[model samples]
Structures are given as structure tokens and as C-alpha cells.
Target: MDDLFARQDVIKRLLNESRRWAFVGLGDNPEREVHTQARLLQRRGKTIVPVHPSAATVLGEKGYAALADVPGQIDVVGVYRRAEHAGAVVDEAIAAGAGAVWLPLDVIDEAAARRAQEAGLDVVMNRCPAVEWALRR
Candidate 1:
């Protein structure tokens, strides 16, 4: 990934100003990191759109099976799946024309990140939005 890809300012903007965050792999289990992170983002006033095949509502928000299924524009796509699965989600985010792609802690894919950057989408890898919010807020 290029410097612009993981730039702190760009990531911060996504973490701060992005209103609609589609969280891929976010399910109903409160024990999952995605679940808690989604809640934290919601607490900070970001609209969290859950994207899971389960199609379960979470944190009072309805769920969609995929990013393309979401009706409106998505500012950021927060990927919560395994490292192997994150690339596909990143590609989907790019295809969906999202402003940025956020790969949470432990979910890293350099090629996917490069793809996202090449697509003109800001990329944040191996970082947690909730932690970033804590530091920035």
C-alpha cells in the first residue's frame, strides 16, 4: 500500500466524518469485536449498516446480506471477516464506490489495500475504528 493508502488524515476522516459505515461480517453476536465496534461507532453518531448473510438486525439497525444490496451510498466499509476473506470485501467496497475501506485488527491484505488505494478509496488495515475513535475523540 502507498503512503496515501494508509494516511492517518484520510483514515481519521473516514473514522470521523463518514456517516454511513457498512460493516461487512457484522452479526448479531454481541461478543464479537465487530458488534462492539459497531456499537462504539454508533455511539459516536455514525450510521452502522450491518452486512451479514444472517440478515439479523444489530444495535437497532436493519441488516443487509451484501454491500451492493444497500440502497444508499456508503461512506466507509468496515471489514470484520478473516484475513483471507477481507480482500473480497475490499473489492466489493471498491465496486460499491465507497469512500474508504477499513480492515479491522488482524485482518490484513496488502494487495487488497493496494487495490482499494488504486481505486481512489482510502484504506485502513489492521486497525480498529473504535480504538481510533478513542484516540481521536
Candidate 2:
């Protein structure tokens, strides 16, 4: 396993400090793992920004069609797409100038992560935010 994707300190800091998270692929469907993860963070007082094609409000948070569409400073961009699509989201996050790019479990894009890191964004890939958050406690 590549340690590049498992930065314990990065995960802890993001989970503890970042307040706004743009969850890509998060939609109205509550069944999706992204929704659940976003909700878990939302319940912890973090603001959730849903970035989905639907652009529908999710978990009481406004939705945007893309990362570029989200207004204000986005602390973290949660990548919930399939591995193949994660790179695009990461690139978008970098372009959006987000503080960090978080690729949840099963989503791994080393090239994207490297690009985001090179862009000065904190990265945590192939890790579940909910699990990491819980592990912190």
C-alpha cells in the first residue's frame, strides 16, 4: 500500500479543522455512501456542499453542478466518484483552489493526488472520511 494516500496527520487535521466540504457525487439519494459520509461530517458541524449533476439540495445543503460552481472558500473537496473518474474531480478541486482533496475509500488516483499535492493541496486518498473521523476519537 502506498503511504502517499494514507496520511494520518492530514486526515486528522482535515477532519478536525476544515469546516466546509464539497462532496462531489453527493446527490439526493441517501443510499449512496457519499451521502452517508457527507452526513456524518455534517452531523459533526461541518457544512456540506453537494456537487452532483442533479444540483439538488442534499442533507439541507445547497448543491452545485461542479466544483467551480461552488461559491466561497471550499476547505475540502470529497471525491466520491469511481476510481476512473476521480482524477477529473481532483483536477477540478485543484482548479477550484480548495485547501484539500479527499478521495474516499475505493477511490484512488495517484496521479491526481500527486497533482493536487503539487498544487499545494492536502491529500488523503483511498480512505473513508467517516472511518478516519471515528478513528481520531
Candidate 3:
């Protein structure tokens, strides 16, 4: 737990340097955190790719059903699913050749985070990219 939080620099780099971000579980619902964060990332100059089972367009951007379905390189996979479901997303992120995996607040899975880190991905768990960006500002 301590080690994950201690890697704040990694998280910052992931959020700052990564160009394309695939947001799993993101949908058209503006009320959801995914939608909010996606907009925030876009505002910060990060390309946001919305990934949802429904394949619904969000925030004027086309959506994909899964990570592998995304056409281009995904530098970061922002996971918004439940804690238990995060492992599968992390695995998919690795398979998709993402540079990092970000599990937002309340999506805690130590094993999944470790797996992502072991796979050479910068992992950020239980943190909000938008909040981090604000703090860095």
C-alpha cells in the first residue's frame, strides 16, 4: 500500500506524458466520474478514449467496447470499474501495450496493481488523475 502511494512521480509522469488514455467503464453519463475525469483530461490536453460495453459516444468522442478494440496506441488505461473487475482491465491494458494503468479512487486491487507494475506499467491506484493535475498546478 505504501509503495504504491510512494510512487507519486510515476503517476505524475503517466498522467503528464501519456498521450492517449483509454477510460474503461466510461459512458455518456455526465454524472459519472469517468465522464468528469475524461473531460478534465481533455481539458488538460490529454486525448481521451472512452471505453464502454455500450460503445456509446461520450463528450463528442467515439467510444470503444474494450481496450483491444481501440484503434491506436493507448498510453494509459484509466480504470473506472469495481475493485474486483479491475484485474481483468489491468490484464487487458497490458495486452493492449499500454504504458501505464491507473485505477482511480475506490478501485483498489493490490494484486492487480502489482501485476501491472510487474508488467512494466506505471500503476496508480486509488488516485484521481484530475485531482493530481490540480495539485500539480
Candidate 4:
């Protein structure tokens, strides 16, 4: 596995610089981690684009059925799906020309992370953006 995940500089940069975060698998359920994290990002002034099959509007932002459906640049692609499904989302994020791919918390897919990195996108896996932000304080 690549050492990219261990790089604090990269994590800090992604968390600090990236503005628009497209959260794949984000649903309308407020109890879900995706919803909470997306809200946190929004509270921090980052634009959150929810991407799900239903394309339900989440956190007051219009949702898209897929990453491709999201118009304009995506600064970060946050994968809230299971590890097995993450690669496909990462691929879509790459296709959408995102600046980075973030696999939250327990979600881990080394191959997908590698693929995103190979595609010139920053990758952060097995991490929570909210926690990362808290740690910076």
C-alpha cells in the first residue's frame, strides 16, 4: 500500500484547501454518518454535493444520482459506501476530475486509493473529515 494515507501534510492540505466535496452514497437520513459529515463540511463553509441513486436533496443542497450528474468541479469525492463499492465511486470521481478522494472512517480500499492517486487525485482513506478537522483545532 502507498504511504499517501499516512501523510499528514496531504490530509491537512485536502481538508484545508478543498472547498467542494461530493459525498457519494450520501442519503437523506440524518442518522447516517454521511449526513453528519456532510453537515459538518457545510458548517465549515465547504460546498457539499450529495450523490446517491435516489438523488434526494440532502442538507439543503441538491443531490445528484451520480458523480457525473454533478455539474462543475468537485474538490473532493467523499466515499460513504462499503469498501467493495468504493472503487467504482473513486473511478467516477476521477472521471469527474475531482481534486481528491476521501474514504471515511472504517472504509478501506487500498487498490482504489492507489488508483485515485495514480490518476493524479489526492487520496485519504480510513479517516473521518470531522475528526481530522477537530484535531486541527
Backbone collision count in every prediction?
A: 0, 0, 0, 0
**Candidate 2: residue 25 Cα off by (Å):** 0.2
* Runs of candidate 2 exceeding 4 Å displacement: none
Error of 4 at 7 (Å): 1.4
| lDDT of each residue in 3-92, candidate 1, tens digit only | 545578977788768899999988999998999989988998999999999988999999999999988899999999999998899999
Q: What are the per-residue Cα lDDT tens digits for candidate 2 across 1-137?
A: 59887878888899999999999999999999998999999999999999999999998888999999999999999999999999999999999999999998888889999999999999998888888877878
The RMSD of every model to the true structure, in order and in angstroms, is 1.5, 0.8, 1.1, 1.1
RMSD of 1: 1.5
Off-target runs (Cα >4 Å) in candidate 3 are: none
Ranking according to TM-score, highest score first: 2, 4, 3, 1
For candidate 3, the TM-score is 0.95
Compared with the true structure, all predictions reach lDDT values of 0.88, 0.92, 0.88, 0.91
Which is the leading candidate under lDDT? 2
Q: Please give, for residues 35-60, the per-residue lDDT of candidate 4 as tens digits.
A: 99999999999999999999999999
lDDT of 4 at 97: 96
lDDT of 3 by residue, 22-103 (tens): 9999998899988899999998888889999999998888999999899978988999999999999999999999988888
TM-score of candidate 1 on Cα atoms, chains taken together: 0.94
